[model samples]
Target: MSLLLERHGQCLCGAVQLDCRLDNSDVSACHCQTCRRWGGGPLLAVECAQPPVIGGGDALGIHASSDWAERGFCIHCGTHLFYRLKAEPHYAIPVGLLEGEDWSLASEVFIEEKPAWYCFANQTRQLTGAELFAEHGQPDDA
Candidate 1:
């Protein structure tokens, strides 16, 4: 996607809407425990350089899952919104939320934590938990 391309999306209930520019068309999957528990599987998302413009502020909820990161969701519909790094302006938004956009899997993180019951057919770079922390900086506890 071009840097100038903007996308719009909303939660299941349409109580919250997002407007943001696409930093790339490549999507990444996170199989970390937190992500899996949050969404029932891996989180397939695209990183946005800037936080999306959030509509219906009152319908948005944020949970600080770790000292260095937080998860956002729609309060009304409980739709996972994004995973945000506390020290940065970036956001990893769920690809499913960006309706009508085609995103290709580029990578997968926390590969070691992924369950064996399911797997992706995509051939993408995979990173273990240790590698993810090393590359992105560990959470406070790490």
Candidate 2:
């Protein structure tokens, strides 16, 4: 039998919830400064086919840390829920959102910007700024 696209997620308080179609398990750990400050670690996220049908979207607080990025979290419990790029318009749901499952599958991104104190060591791919920019355009290498 073909496997179904299973999905399940919850907020810090278990009050907010989500259910949706997950295209793939492949996840990304973002090491940008904004991510580090918001999540206290690399942000583990999975791109969803569509926005998860959230139960408490209203209760979620939005923090626009940068002109291009906005972060959403639970106001009551302060659980970081989503990281969204305004240009992309798609929500990068935190893998932690998946409450009780093996939510692992993220590759690393923006490792060059990561702090030295926290060592990735052997966790995920470490992408230099130049390398990441090359994947798209001529982003400033320096």
Candidate 3:
């Protein structure tokens, strides 16, 4: 038997809404410098097979954060939306933006880059930046 979980949420100002079908109830954290700098801390997110159904497209703003990834946010309230891979149909949506109680920590990426000042007590699989890249293939140098 299997279970399916779906979550719905909106931006800070309620300018954009998201309907996401999660691959699992587990959430992952990214501790890479880029993620830290982007959100002022680790990004706790859930993977989605495709981009969420975004409401109010005009209020959404996208930034090319890296050669292979782009970050989306609400322009009106400066709310973080989702991080999408440019070369693939992959997306990681911030857990905070979604409404659900089924989520649990599953993994942490860029473990080597995680700062020592903060830590999570959850037992999760950890992967360093190199390992993550090796599995997903490094982003183009473009």
Candidate 4:
């Protein structure tokens, strides 16, 4: 598959829209507690290559979820929009928010925090919470 793919998507109420180029077509899932609580399940993460073009008026709501990251949603529809680092321009968006092709489960982050109630059958690269922090830096620094 190509390294990058263009995609467009919007919130449930069409209040917020985004255009972006993504490097990974495979959608990764985040099992971190914050992600689980925020979205009511594992957060399907699709990282953007750069800042996305988000349009619409007064429809975006941003919450500083952590010292290093902030979460966004649609103010009108309450749809989860994105999870982005405060110091970085890139965004790790919910895979469900973007329209594209060739999507598959590639990896799972914060595997250690994943509850036993549900599990995916796909064999994927799994990383523990500490491992994620080790690679991306702790939540305070990541």
lDDT order, best first, reads: 3, 1, 4, 2
Residue 2 lDDT, candidate 4, scale 0-100: 65
Model 3, range 5-104, lDDT digits (tens) per residue? 6789899889999998876888999998999999999999998855788889999999999777899999999999999988777889999999977789
Q: After superposing candidate 4, which stretches have Cα over 4 Å from the reference?
A: 1-3, 139-142
Candidate 1 residue pairs that clash: none
The lDDT of each candidate is: 0.87, 0.72, 0.89, 0.86
Query: Please, what are the lDDT tens digits per residue for candidate 4 over residues 39-132?
Result: 8899987889998899984888999987788989998899998899787675898888888667989999989889999999999999887787
**Inter-residue clash pairs, candidate 3:** none
Which regions of candidate 2 are displaced past 4 Å? 1-4, 121-123, 129-142
Estimated TM-score for each candidate: 0.91, 0.77, 0.93, 0.91
**All candidates: CA RMSD in angstroms?**
1.9, 3.4, 1.8, 2.0
Give the range where candidate 4 is weakest over 10 consecutive residues by summed lDDT: 133-142
Error of 3 at 87 (Å): 0.4
Best by TM-score: 3
Report how far residue 11 has shifted in candidate 1, in Å: 0.5
lDDT of 1 by residue, 4-89 (tens): 55788889999999987876688999999999999989999988767899999999999999888899999999999989988768
So what's the TM-score on candidate 2?
A: 0.77
Candidate number of the best lDDT: 3
